[model samples]
Target: MALAGVRVVELAGLAPVPFCGMILADFGAKVIRVDRTKVTMAMDTQARGKRSLALNLKTPEGVSVLRKLCVQSDVVLEPYRKGVMEKLGLGPEELLKENPRLIYARLTGYGQSGSYAAAAGHDINYLAMSGLLSMLGRRGEKPYAPLNLVADFAGGGLTCALGVVMALLERSQSGRGQVIDTSMVEGAAYVGSFMWKSRSIGMWNNPRGENMLDSGAPFYDTYQTSDRKYMAVGAIEPQFYSQLLHGLGLDDADLPSQMSFSDWPKLRQVFTDCFATKTQAEWRAVFDGTDACVTPVLSLEEVSSHPHNQQRESFLQDSQGEESPRPAPVLSRTPAQPCQGRDPFIGEHTRAVLEEYGYQPQDIDRMLSTGVLECNAAKARL
Candidate 1:
């Protein structure tokens, strides 16, 4: 309940914007998702703990309603390309003029003022352009995408949320709000700072996958077991490496020096052969409670039932009976509550929200009848 009094108006879009709103809502912020009247409401996991208001922004009445919401809200999160909001007369300049303490956060692939600002791109494209993609795959293989986690959610949503919180903190002193331009490409590069800085330290001079943490070291890679499942190894320090060798039933005197680059492939093969002697479960039992830094690579279906995950209650079933991850980075004082209901249908709370914003029942009826607003019951099914 850290953000108990915070109000966030989230313009519904794809992953990034919804993700930002989800984090806010998780921490007790009231998040209202503004969706287009014509769009169908997909069951987006990010829509948990949020209400929906469906309006046609193309209509002047709809724009007026949004402006009124901004006048009383603390933050507005948008993921449109540059100039889209300006065309609708809801740009930062106009909105901030109405409410000086409003935080206008813009999340996009590029930035608000870049050559690629208006170009359409997804997570893969942003990662490719950020130079982070070049350092991803094996030395000679094509770089494997990390599946939208890096750019779309981590870079875009998480970064924007952090910026919004920081701006809010600063506003406490300045008593003014400013526009936040968050570019996923720039955010992606920022998150890969260690990779970029490592080059000057000579630790990252080699090609991708030829470095210590990139699966170059024999002690820091995955090996296949007899049953074809894999175990991840991260015996980085000398003590952990020693534990790993002990668990593998190998004598130190018989093996090559641990840090010898020339011996990596041979040692990796040794590990591969040794792991192939048992199934993943067998090896898991072997190193069950030791600090050997080895663990089975679990499949998605196997995760919820895993002992550690079950002990920690890392995943929980939502009100709709779907398994979803719990809110993370646990807080001692203000722990987040589990979300309690299904995601709102499009315009499910449109009437209620309009009433809260001071619109009379007659006004709501006129707007609904004029094609300026919509509700789930009025929309045609696909």
Candidate 2:
């Protein structure tokens, strides 16, 4: 495991922080998720590979406990509007004084200091600020957010994790850790760097959705099949486009040049009518394993059983028999491990986690008796 012996204190929030914690846990870090005292069932897939400790941070005792945890932790993930942690006395300035090796990773929408830093926003808002939203979706339609994937997960969570890893590498030589102020807005723009840089060149010449990769090109978009399902096409090269035409039983000689932007609508309609003549499965038979770059638009429930995914174990059944995606970026050796068991109920590991952190039995019992801690069992139907 790459992150073996790393201990992460994840102050639980929504999407981004949990996802960051999950990635560290996947790589063998021991992640303890600090949840609110009152919590419901675990519906989050990102909750995997974590132990939960429900503590009311609004209380002095809970904040003290968290401070102690940070003093002993390798990484502390904070996902809040700016100033919340500082108000709680758990900010990096205080914690890093105690634990010089602490990687205080802050994941936020705006950042530590900015015009919108104190304002509230969600994934869509962050993406919009990043300027990534303006180029998304179809040509004439309003900019459609891609369900929070770009900002929340890819930009915020994934970028924060990468920063934490790089900080760890730097700390090995410096013998000191640093704070990572990861703003989702900046991260989203960085993640979309390719598109941004390409736009200035010839790649993205037209307006939104009128470009080659943005569903503007008839050969690179999705088409509905006879079964009402869809297939995605990305036959950009001359060779692959030839394969796409051949798969559709069309001759290249009769069609417009592959790059004719003016004729794209005509080409799209022709491909649409042709795709509608066959089931998605039939088209899969024609294009699968070929260089056409055509693949069925599989549903959530359908992906686990797909031949390629199954062979690679891209999706695996967890301890509760629920199918979840496996950890990605496979390593030749010491590959990341999937979450082992059913996710913990809120506060399920409160007592156990406290004991692991060197709290005595009496201390644990006192915290449990007070309003400081909560220990629970059984899953809620949240």
TM-score of each model, paired residue for residue = 0.96, 0.97
Could you give candidate 2's per-residue lDDT for residues 197-314 as a string of tens digits? 8867898888999999889999989999999999999999999999999999999889988888999999999999999999999999999989999999999999998999999989
Candidate 1: tens digits of C-alpha lDDT, residues 251-308: 9899998989889889989998999999999999988899999999999788888999
- For model 2 the local lDDT of residue 314 reads 95
Clashing pairs in 1: none
Which stretches of candidate 1 lie above 4 Å from their native place? 377-382
| lDDT values for all models | 0.90, 0.91
Q: After best superposition, candidate 2 residue 350: deviation in angstroms?
A: 1.1
Off by over 4 Å in 2: 42-44, 377-382
lDDT measured at residue 83 in model 1 versus the true structure, 0 to 100: 98
> For model 2, what is the C-alpha lDDT against the true structure?
0.91
